[model samples]
Target: MPMEIRLVRIDDRLIHGQVATVWAKVTKVNRILVVSDDVAKDILRKTLLKQASPPGVIVNVITIDKMISIFNDPKFNDFKSMLLFTSPRDARRVVEGGVKLDTINIGGMSFSDGKKMITNAVAVNSEDIEDLKYLNEQGIKLEIRKVVADNKVYMMDLLKKEKMI
Candidate 1:
């Protein structure tokens, strides 16, 4: 069962304005699946995320492992969805778990400890660089763009320029 995962994004603020309002309209995916262990366990955060969803679009905040399991569950594969991850490592894990995705959008990763600022609104830690490099080496396309209005900047190309990967 090829899950209709229209887009994969790594946004720390899972279902924020750009995703809730802009990208959702751009991708036209009816469902939003936020796959993150931390968010899935926080009831308050999960509720807030659901509330932010655009009308007519359903949102599900689920654990990373559960998300991987859903691929085999026919009931979960019925709708087209935009997949969200909080980190590049998790995104890599899901693809490794067998979900089909050729391109990933680097939406926004907030600067935190161990993270190096790559581009404005985008940052990468050592693990993030490693995982993203792995995805690129495995033939996945990576783009860092905040919204539809911004130009699509292929992240791997920048990484090469920086000698990070």
Candidate 2:
């Protein structure tokens, strides 16, 4: 089926309990691909993420370019992967790189310097807003939810409420 992308989630804290247990079960993904340049470069972090994954599910940490490469390769068609990104900017880059994404789940973005809180679990800076806006412009549905059981909140609605859009 050409490597089904079960879900594309943006969570600063990747591969957490909710992701490992809930999302993994809901999506029925055999592989969890963490596409982050920083995490892929950090050996300790890479190993930790792998260790954090749920049993029976393989986890791979790789750069965005590598993801695009394997995604386009025929040999990788056997995987049903759930892609994890740390930021909307990285997700946007992958989208621009020609990976078709219909939707992106904004799992969590903790409060950081110069960022405004949109939701308790989500915060955004000007750069984040721009990247998110770009993704929205590409006709991708952006939703915010900490877990599968949580009600889906449309990201643009929150942005509009915050007057960021």
Candidate 3:
């Protein structure tokens, strides 16, 4: 059984305006799996996110563990799905745990005090950069593109320019 999963966008602000407006429309995805341990346990946030989703779209707030299990399961192989993660660490963990996928899109990772700004839209803390390097080392194609319209930026290019990786 083969699955049709495309464009795993990593954005901390799950189910936001950008996601609903740009990604959902551009990708034409009907199902969104919010793969995060935090949201999975928080009933309030989960309910709000589910309510915020556009009609005809199904949203599932699940943990990384659940995602790993589901990815390995033979049943979901027939489903057309889109996976969303909140952070680079979670993304790296999912891949390291054997959730085999090719490319990941870095959508909007906000800046913190210690984070080095990669682009106008993307910022990276040390841990986040390390996670990206780990994903790159694993042969996963990582690109930084805020919206469907923006030009794609490779992690290696950003890393080299910033001297992080």
Candidate 4:
């Protein structure tokens, strides 16, 4: 069997309380792949994320290319993973690089300069909107929910309501 990618989520916070606790349980994934070049290079953040991992779940901070490579390798087929990306562009890159993902959860994109709030937790700039639209156009389901219990909202609908698309 191929590597089972249980969930693909985009959250700028990466691994945090909600992710390490709630998401890991909900996804039933043994591995959490933090697929980001920036975080992979930051030793402090990488160590922090590893320390923040859930009891049984293994966390790996790796670049986009490394994720693509390992994901394609047959040797890693036993991994049931939940991939975390800091941006829609990164998720798009991994998808375009040949990771077969059908849905991406927009967990949290914190308020930042030059970004407009779509929801209480999600803020997106023009570039983010573009990348999100590209993923939507590629027939990927974009869901917005901070936690598994929250009602899932469609990203495109929020974009349309905000007049972003």
**Cα lDDT over the full model 4:** 0.92
1 or 2, greater by TM-score? 2
lDDT of 4 by residue, 1-165 (tens): 568999899999998889999989988999999999999999999999999999899999999999888877899898989999999999999888888888999999989899999899999999999999889988999999999899999999989988888
For each candidate, the alpha-carbon lDDT, in order, equals 0.88, 0.93, 0.83, 0.92
Where does candidate 1 clash, by residue pair? none
Candidate 2 positional error at 55, Å = 1.4
Measured over all alpha carbons after superposition, the RMSD of each candidate to the real structure, in angstroms, is 1.2, 0.8, 1.5, 0.9
- Segments in model 4 whose C-alpha atoms lie over 4 Å from true places: none
Candidate 2 residue spans exceeding 4 A from truth: none
Top candidate (lDDT):
2
Q: Against the hidden true structure, what lDDT does model 2 obtain?
A: 0.93
Q: Report the number of the highest-TM-score candidate.
A: 2
| TM-score winner, 1 or 3 | 1
RMSD of 1: 1.2
Report how far off residue 62 is in candidate 4 (Å): 0.4
* Candidate 3 lDDT for residue 32: 86
Candidate 3 lDDT score at position 97:
81
lDDT string, candidate 2, 1-165, tens digits:
457899999999999999999999999999999999999999999999999989889999999999888887888887899999999999999988888899999999989899998898999999999999999999999999999988999999989988888
Q: Of 1 and 4, which scores higher on lDDT? A: 4
